[model samples]
Target: MNKSTFNTASAIALAAAALAGPAVAQQATAVEEVIVTAQRSSQNLQQVPLAVTGYSGAFLERSKIEDFNDLRTRTPSLTFEQFAPGQPRYTIRGIGGGGGVAVFVDDVYMGQPSMSSVEFVDLERVEVLRGPQGTLFGRNATGGAIAFFTEKPGSDYRVKAKATVGNYDLKSVSALISGPVSDVLSAKISVIAREHSGYAFNETTGRDIEDETLAAARAALRFRPNDDWDIQLNIDGSTRRGTAPWWDLMIEAPKSAGKSNPEPRRGRNHTDDGYADIDNAGVSLNANWDSPIGTFTSITAFRNTQSHNRANTTGLLVAPLSDVANRRVNFHTLFIQQADQKAEQFSQELRLAADLGDRFKWIGGLYYYQDDGVANRLTDYRFYGFGPTPVDGRYAYASTNETKAFAAFMSGTFALTEQLKLQAGIRWSHDEKDHTTVASGKNFSGFRDGGVSVPGYSAASSADWSAWTPTASINYQVTPDVFVYGTISRGFKSGGFSDGDSEKQSILRPFNPEFVWNYETGARTEWFDRRLRVNATAFYMDYTDLQVSVFTQLAPNLPAVLVSGNAGKAKIKGFELEWNAVPIEGLNLYGNYTRTESEISALISGANNLAGKKIPRAPENKFFMGASLARDFGGMTATGRVDYTYQSDYFSSINNVPSERVLAQENWDAGLTMGPAGGAWSVEVWGKNLANELHVVSISDILGDAFANYAPPRTYGVTLSYRH
Candidate 1:
């Protein structure tokens, strides 16, 4: 359907619901209340002055939100995409890039994007905080933050298991067991395994590509020696192996070098299959002590990850072949790239919180973090079809990076009167980064004299930066069922060097940090005797020193390299509306809408004049609506749910080229579940992307050729679950 028609329909549905809500409200029940920790403390969702979306574990399971990608579909003003397999990126409110948004699991920061694709297993809830979160988070959270809270070990013994079978030979199994080991000790364990057949056809191998196999497990131990202190330890690990999706060439290359494919879910490769393998593991220790003065908390964590990938740079099914010296050569076979990367991080955090009577409360913390990583890559552009030895045009590089950071933050709230409050926060952060690289190449094409040999060279660079971010807000309780708040906050992201390029100049040049100031006002209200809850927010951001990545050639004869640079300035304004209601018994409804506008106001000299261009991955309009109904029949309960989502068109790059635009898309999902009331067993039948819409998630322009990656297609499954 067209945009106009879809919007009109959405408006009508919303209006009808609003008109009918009060008439039936006398019989409706009160909506359930949700508690969140968006501000580092537990508070009612409706009372928190920030814009956050929360989903309970039960809701997630009912909606079949199995992964991070699925969660993004239900959150307003949030977008997720992958440039390549194992590389995940998130954008919120038109602000995103490397490290723009941060992810946390049980308060432990995740420093690597490769770990962002974790499965949702045994989670208590997931919270998505929109806008800047620099003061409390104190990291690279210029856009926002996503936090996952896992289920903790309980004193009672319990067991839960679930199994799923779906189309394309999909199979998944997950289990969780929790119990008390002793009077003062409790433990829990959770494990999951999933495998699925490929969705894209591979004609060359006569086998499907983009298949996946994954396994993950988590173990936890909690010790409560006495009422004054408690300690908890958690260990987790995961592994993934998958055939990477082959890029679809959207534009034909010159001289028939690469073939174009209009189909998004089809692949044709003349050479080896593209694939990715990733492994990640982490451990964390948390301790809490209650003192006469206040409460003290400490968190220590360590994580490590490794990944390897192989991809066909030129997605070509066929190419012109020629014979030189009685040897057959095909140029398409020469386009290949491989990379290996490893990273590890360690962090420590200490916090103290206290309540000064009932009028004032405060929290303060100190954080220290360190990380090290290395990456190796090889790119070949020579015909290897004739023999084992290639002619020329080969490049290889190894790069290493290290970082150490320290931060101190404090936040507090003071009640001025019975209905008015003031809140303020500040964070001071210091970061040091070091980078080194060794690169070498031979017989590069388009260089002087048709070829040039690059000797092995090493480069090193180091830099340090510091920033102070702060926030201030005022909240007023208009009534027992209404709240209004206004806030001004600043966010900062650290500066770093670019190591993707083989050139020394690009490796040594460090980009500046990015900063943004956000001004937002929001209102939360409940009507119809608490049966309906509606929250609305309007925000404007003054963004500066945006770090952008661009591929460019230093000189006419040099190869193009990816580099990080700072853009002049930009402006972003947006608004969001979220509502939840139970207009009648046995029925629940929820919906959200987001409207955003982002434009670059200035550009660096010598760069393309993109002052009025839209930011990449920032869609203008997004909407989601879902409904569920439950009924009792013959001592059993039956529940049915349906959801719909729409996303407007967006560009993949800052250049805003037509070929790089991702078209507007819509999706639908549904599920039906049945089980005995208060029973131990249940069954659910579910379907996702029921309409089988083909939408592009990412696009890249390489040497005048555009390649695109498509989202997953239709899938249906059945799940059986048991609890004790």
Candidate 2:
């Protein structure tokens, strides 16, 4: 950690200790309780018998967690990476990427990576479950699951609105209104708009880059005709327009010949200012019927997304040799890439829950899902020279993939005694996929020569896979304030063909499915009359046929292409410690620490045997600490909060090249709010990354050059909110 970060963290720690010293001597209060649905049923978080994290909507708003990247700083063993604004990738316990982790919104699966950065408008809570959850969640739950629950319409009327202004010309406004339309109907609506100026500058274009504008809206309706039947419907849509993420050229290519420096800067020399545009919309319907025997629930959902992006892949402005002296040219571009993607998915689920007796309870569910996606990409390389004419080479690639999946799952809990319980669950899943690809390239002898078409290829393939995943756990209540559990579970992820590869072999053969066996033990305890709560978990996972993506050349003269294949075996083990304390009334302290170790145990044949390499994006250690205090003075209330987070260094690729390593980082955030006691209006001032730390979040190495994406710099904002 740097000097500024160390000092900021130390100050917060000292302040927390100082407050606790005197507060501990006073009368303590019970910590707040959190309810979650990790097991497909509502239960207290401390009694869930799983490694999970829950965040209330109020807490998220106070912390200013606007997106998934902000949430990763507070959660343990969670890693988030984004090459651009709309495309995001998440990892948990060294397992992620390409269907390894499942994301859900109101019990509806989000199948596309572009949908990962949805707006957190009006939410009841967010839950992050670690380890395997395949038995209950069905397919693509190998790493774990993230579920987001939105607040439902209530009988009473409510209105909430918020506005924020920040540095970098940031502006945001959001509002939500919910009320009862009649005795049997309720409705709710929420909308948000946010915009910000660019953070980076384009030296060549003389314009700002990395700016963003977003707008989203959601509507919901609930109907209750009788005491036993209930129905709800939700619709949401969002649009995002932004410049491409800023990438620092950390290392120059060997062919550059001293034209660029190998240092990180906030300026780029791209000829064109790239752009990203994304549109996403979804709808869901849910119905429930209560009967004497059990409760039956049905959920049907559909989603569609489209995105178009253009970027200067090389991050360089190359001039033709003939115009080197003038330092100016008509076409001063080196390389450019453009991508257009479209995806749509539909899912249906039916579930039943019942209690046979006081000693046993069970739940069963059936699920079906289908999705289709298409991606078209273009790559232009100006190898020989720069001009207004045709370039030296141009490549176009397109792919379409379709998937269908079905699953049935059931789980039961039998209380052997008052203090001991046995839980078991199983799921049978079947998946089918069809993929097609078309690739072609055009080559030119020079800027003035005629173009020649290279050999093109088109191929199609289909594959199917099936898996039976199971889970078993034993739980014992040592006392009313303490609980312990041990569990074993299995997870599976289906396989598919690679895209952007023109080779016939790549399309003819599809990758195999990956599987994991996870073993875990955990404990939850409270002390000092429920004033302090602690939770700890230890887990180990064994993986077989692990799917991995690597960049390789199909031939000596062709450009590199990404290919997906199965690896031999791998292992990952990790432990987490989390604690929350309410030493005295109006004072709260919370923190978590995590340690992870991941390694490849074996490699496929003909490989150079990189068996012990660390998994990509898996940091060794992660720590978070925070304190919040609220005080009332006469007719007004004031709350102050401070938090710190730390993450160890990690590599961005399986190769673990030193140049591609993301360095360790430390961050600090603080916020203060003031309002009238029990009033309808309030104001808050918040700052993130107070230490102004510069750290890389992702890196890509191509052609001996390393490009890095850095986290956002220091930002401060003020918000005004009204509730009635």
Assess every candidate by TM-score: 0.91, 0.91
The TM-score of predicted model 1 comes to 0.91
- lDDT (Cα, tens digit) per residue for candidate 2, span 1-724: 1234323332332232221111011122677678999998899888988899999887788778888878899998999987766667788987888868889998898999887667887988999999988898966889989899988897987676777889988877777778899999999887777778887777767877778887777889999988998899999988888887667667666543314434354554667788988889999999999989899999999999998888775566554334466574433335677889999999999999999999999999999999999999887776433234534678787899999999999999999999999999999999999999887775222111112233777778899999999999999999998999999999999988887655556666898999999999999999998889999999999999988876554434333456678777999998999999998898989999999999988864223465888888889999999998888888788889999999999988776777678889899999998887777667999999999887776787665567776777888999887766
Candidates in order: C-alpha RMSD to true structure: 8.7, 7.8
lDDT of 1 by residue, 91-134 (tens): 99877778899999999999888766677979989999999898
Stretch of 10 with least lDDT, candidate 1: 18-27
The residue ranges of model 2 lying beyond 4 angstroms of the native Cα positions read: 1-29, 253-265, 320-333, 383-392, 443-454, 553-559, 605-607
User: Which regions in candidate 1 have their CA more than 4 angstroms from the true location?
Assistant: 1-29, 253-257, 318-334, 382-392, 443-456, 553-560
Looking at model 2, residue 227 earns an lDDT score of: 93
Q: What is the lDDT of candidate 1?
A: 0.81
Candidate with top lDDT is 1
Candidate 1 at residue 480, lDDT?
A: 93
